[model samples]
Target: MHLPEIRRSHIAIAVISGLLFSLSFRLNQYFDALFVYSAGISLLFLPAGVKLLAVLVGRLPAIVGIMVVSVHLGASIWPDKPMTAIVYFAFVSLMTYPIATLGVMRLFHIRKNLSNLRYHHIVVLSVVASILNGLVHNWLYLAQGVTTSEELWHKSAAMALGDFMGCFVVVAFFHAAMGVLRSARNPQID
Candidate 1:
């Protein structure tokens, strides 16, 4: 595709991904830690073939917008800490995927295939995203004074394990769904 076409496609992907992220987050925030899975699934599955830059550019605004809306929606939930919750959500959202991608790139040596949504790329991404999602989030919680040093290591590890497991579950479902959908559209190719 030409530059203009690629730009539009990237924007469209971001917007759609953001919408999906916000919707998932909004509907499931009450679940607390479960939001990690929703987040992993939302952020990873949508922009598979898009470059990381495009995903960031597209989803950041949508996520921020969702965060802003949450300030109002969550006012009733955390009457005293709505802003805190909003800011935490925004910060975690900002930190999770980029850090995860970086970890995958460095650890998996898959930097060259970032633009392609191959199986290995998805696996590495899901693993990295899950691990970082837990670390960044629990570290934030620790910073916020929710956990003391005594529990930091174990707590973070447990959360990371949960996030990774949840990511794989969602990944399996989405991967299978994508295969079915693609096969339906391209029966001859499949």
Candidate 2:
């Protein structure tokens, strides 16, 4: 219900989802077993680190987005299969990161005080983070000889769409979670 409680719930959900997804991939042979294992590790640790940094820096959402992007970048560079690496990075940065960051932001009502200037700032930060995330993944794939310029452009477009979709899902989840928490915290009033 409170900020701390909400944070815990988010972390728990993220962890559970990450684990379930990784296990599913492993079971279905969607990825290399090692890759799926590594992804699971990253999902558990990277977001937690990002959230801590964000909280300490007092720019929670933006910093979390950046760190999530950084995680994707690192993952992209570590894989032998460039396409797989790029896809993984895209999923995490463009899909998971945006959703998680937006969820936390909306849950806390962080945009309540936004003026046009502040709104612009938030949008700019999110866009920058998303672009940087896509570029990093694309660059990795290019460096690994996995994709040409045309393919890179296509992937970039997909990355952008993933980011938008992620943001939408995360924001919606935040709203739902916040409502649930609010009700739990104030059952008598409700």
Candidate 3:
């Protein structure tokens, strides 16, 4: 996109999402669990704001880059083991973002109209994204050295389920964010 147009919006969304996720981080000692849960919400809700900014600026690449870098940095500094966190970020970006983007685009016939995707489409996208997210977690576990194929599969399944749950949370958050954005964009007679 135009870069300039969306830069402000992207920054705003990133800041807000980062703050919200940080709040989640403080809520529990099981930092990984809390981060993953917050991540799902962040992915679903945050992307739209990013997309909005991208469209305005015509700087999709910058938006994506910012997201990847932010997530990577977050993972690098997370309380959990650094390696595991990096793996999680990689999976979320590589696998999750693509799958969710595809599933939602296909389901809604979105045609890349990122600015106006329906809420349901966003939810579907988030679900797919979450599934990919879980896969990444499982992959990380395996990379640490899986003893058996069955163990690998088991971890994979568990990660998938966790991703799905996280996706759902993200979808809910996305809808709320969309509503707020819509209201702000169209304040009317009351």
Best by lDDT: 1
Question: Candidate 1 on 97-188: residue-level lDDT in tens?
Answer: 66667666667565443433456766677667766765676676667666677877766666666555545555555656777887898789
Question: How much lDDT does each candidate structure score?
Answer: 0.54, 0.44, 0.50
For residue 156, model 3's alpha carbon misses the true position, in angstroms, by 2.1
lDDT (C-alpha) at residue 106 in model 1: 65
Candidate 3 structure lDDT: 0.50
Q: Model 2, which residues run further than 4 Å from truth? A: 1-128, 187-190
lDDT of 1 at 182: 77
lDDT of 3 by residue, 1-190 (tens): 5578667776665555444444433432254544343332322233333332232223344445445555655565554656555655543544445555656666677766466666676556655665665566556545544324566665555555554544555555656777899899999997
Q: Predicted candidate 2: what Cα RMSD to the true structure? A: 10.5
| TM-score for all models, in order of appearance | 0.59, 0.40, 0.53
Best by TM-score: 1
Residue pairs clashing in model 2 are none
Predicted structure 2, TM vs. truth? 0.40
Count clashes in each candidate, considering only residues at least 3 apart in sequence or on different chains. Answer: 0, 0, 9
lDDT of 2: 0.44
